[model samples]
Target: MADTQFSLVPKVINGGIAGIVGVTCVFPIDLVKTRLQNQQPGPNGQLMYKNFRDCLVQTFKKEKFFGMYRGSGVNLLLITPEKAIKLVGNDFFRYHLKQEGKKLSLTREMIAGSSAGACQIIVTTPMELLKIQLQDAGRTATVEGSKAAAVKPPKISATSIAMQLIKEKGITGIYKGCAATALRDITFSAIYFPLFAHLNSLGKRKEGSHEAVFYVSFISGLAAGCVASFSVNPLDVVKTRLQTLTKGSSDKTYTSWMHCFRSTLKHEGVLAFFKGAGCRIMVIAPLFGIAQTVYYVGIAEYILGIKK
Candidate 1:
């Protein structure tokens, strides 16, 4: 790896921009993924959604175009800090872990990535908890309605959800799935950062720059994002299930990640672990692709005249 002046301001700006762009483009797919993961099989093995496409269609049919972005308010608002912490934290760790004339080993890379992942959980857990509730609310409301009088689900907002959670469970209420979120994010970063770095390194560099060409970085991010997203999907499923606290009485409850993993496997079969794997890959690939492209483009650096 090459050295650049370590500056937080530009990196933070770049990360926030990357997150906003990526999330804007892919939030709908992510919403679908959450619904799929949260959906439980009905009595007699029926599922609300046949698959990702069905889920998308149903959401569009019921909620229309903007409905797909149901929980985007909180996600978009918090993702700036969430991504800023993850990306910038990774860079901070990697820069510190690098030794003079020593190659950055894979283990160290993973450690750096994991550290970044851990650091972001402070923001990620609460953001995801609120986002999941809002995202899955529409689907669950419809399901509950089918068993009773048909009525429109009440409009819910992120602020309302946060306030309710805080009032009920105090501040920690919003971090209902912190442990599961940490597991998913740490594992994802451990896999993604090292792989992205290695693949990005193989690409042709700019004339005198250590950075790979923008397209190469984007492709590297996409590929790594897909693999990492797929690998941690089971954890993501578990996390989503854990965070969604509004399940009906019949829904199975899990006390921990292992318990959820085992229960889901036993009840829904092994495939349950990957309920939204396809949507996850779709959402993550382009998300990281655009994010990496933007990050490497140094928009903040350009605006601030900061030399890398």
Candidate 2:
């Protein structure tokens, strides 16, 4: 009887729930992305963000707890659309691929994830720029020993920052880092969804068991967390630079995506690509994964009556 009633609509609902929960829960990592991307290396020639502890402490002392969550509003705006694209797109790709008899392997999942990621980039880029500028207010450039200790940044609020951006650059200015932003959404989705599906498959249990589904979700969440970070780290750095650069730019410096990438790489060392990876793993990935897993499993059971 249950087999007769199973359908794709409930699967989509569960997927949407998972996407929303994942993005919302891991939002702190989004802030972390802003901080890492916007980081200007200290005078000591060392990397700015050593990890989560350093970034967190610095943000509290310099920017404040509220400061860390700079573009939270923008995030809320991006989540629904991004999540929809990520979940629905991935599943759609999976369905088509299966029709072609593609093996449900990690590689196949990555391809589906990559496609979904690319799709979400269009929806997510502008909001991502808003997030970046909000978080970059009075961001410190030097964190070397005494200099790091002595620096007290200018006071600013999200509203003030928004106004400041408008006055300085205009609507386009607020979205200055859009290309990079697109890159982030696309890259993460590409890595996250596929890895998640793979892990869930790994953790599959006997039919009609809530405990089994929960465990599968948990493992899948962990894999998605780790894989998403790797695929999207470089794009994240570029996104941060594009959005966060204010005083440093000439008229044309922030003009295009190519310009942003080349300039950031030229000025900051190659190592800049990996600025906040550890913190992201600790904060963003795990939180997002857990949220995603719960949403996926919970939504399905809710709609389908525990798959009895």
Candidate 3:
């Protein structure tokens, strides 16, 4: 049976609230994941962070605890719309794809997910660019060594960054990594939704029990997110690099997504693609856990007093 029938407004509200909560809970791990993904080995084959723990320790030591949340304001702000489009759009498309009383085929589910992922890119690109810029700021400073410390860091408001990007490269600057973002997100959603659905179905609870649905949703989302996030880590790495803004350099790094892929593989080897796999799994697992639980629980419907 279908889990629930939600109107468009309720779907959006549910998605937005779930996204905010999930992202807020996992932003720190996300920051670390980005930093890990963005780092390449030096001539001596040394990495800035040996592993996730090292990255966490060094980031906190250098940038402080609050620094872990550097780009979270913009992320939290944009994630609402981004996730609303993703979750609601998924259901919207799934509704159309479903034949009455028949479960959606795996292919149909994947198509629905891909559509949702593609739809969110319009908002995701700019939001991600801003967030990556902020999250990678400390890494850039660390790379620059003492010289970076001499110069003060830019203030951390999303408005200031948006204004600066517009001034520097016009509106197009905000969408610096659109291609990579679309590629990663599309692949991720394609994998995530279908897998989550299958897993959730395997562990289905009694019909109309919200509590059972909530717990099952959390477990399924967590499992699906870890697998999907790891599978797409290479694409995610390329996206992070493309979105990140470097200091005083107007030039693009690695040309295009294909170029970025080729360069990373050639230079850093296959293992480089999974640089932040652990941290990414951690971030995504909990993120989807919280998000899916909240979404399934129908808190938005309850708060808004819309009957299911």
TM-score of 2: 0.74
Indicate the worst ten consecutive residues by lDDT in candidate 1. Answer: 145-154
**lDDT of model 3 at residue 134?**
87
Q: Could you estimate the TM-score for every candidate?
A: 0.96, 0.74, 0.92
List lDDT for all candidates, in order: 0.91, 0.63, 0.85
Clashes of each: 0, 3, 0
Candidate 1 residue-wise lDDT, 1-308, digit = tens:
56656889999999999999999999999999999998887777778888988989888878888889989999999999999998899999999999888999999999999999999999999999989988888777887777333334459888998999999999999998899999999999999999999999999998888888999999999999999999999999999999987784457788988899999998889998999999999999999999989998999999999776
The stretch of ten residues in a row with the least summed lDDT in candidate 2 is: 244-253
Q: In candidate 1, which residue pairs get closer than 3 Å at backbone N, Cα or C atoms, i.e. clash?
A: none
* Model 1 bad stretches (over 4 Å): 147-151
Q: Write the per-residue lDDT of candidate 2 for residues 24-74, one digit (tens) a residue.
A: 666666676666656664455555556666766766776566666666766
lDDT of 3: 0.85
When superposed on Cα atoms, how far off is each prediction in RMSD?
1.6, 4.9, 2.7
lDDT of 1: 0.91
Q: What is the lDDT of residue 13 in candidate 1?
A: 99
Query: After best superposition, candidate 1 residue 192: deviation in angstroms?
Result: 0.4
Error of 1 at 241 (Å): 0.2
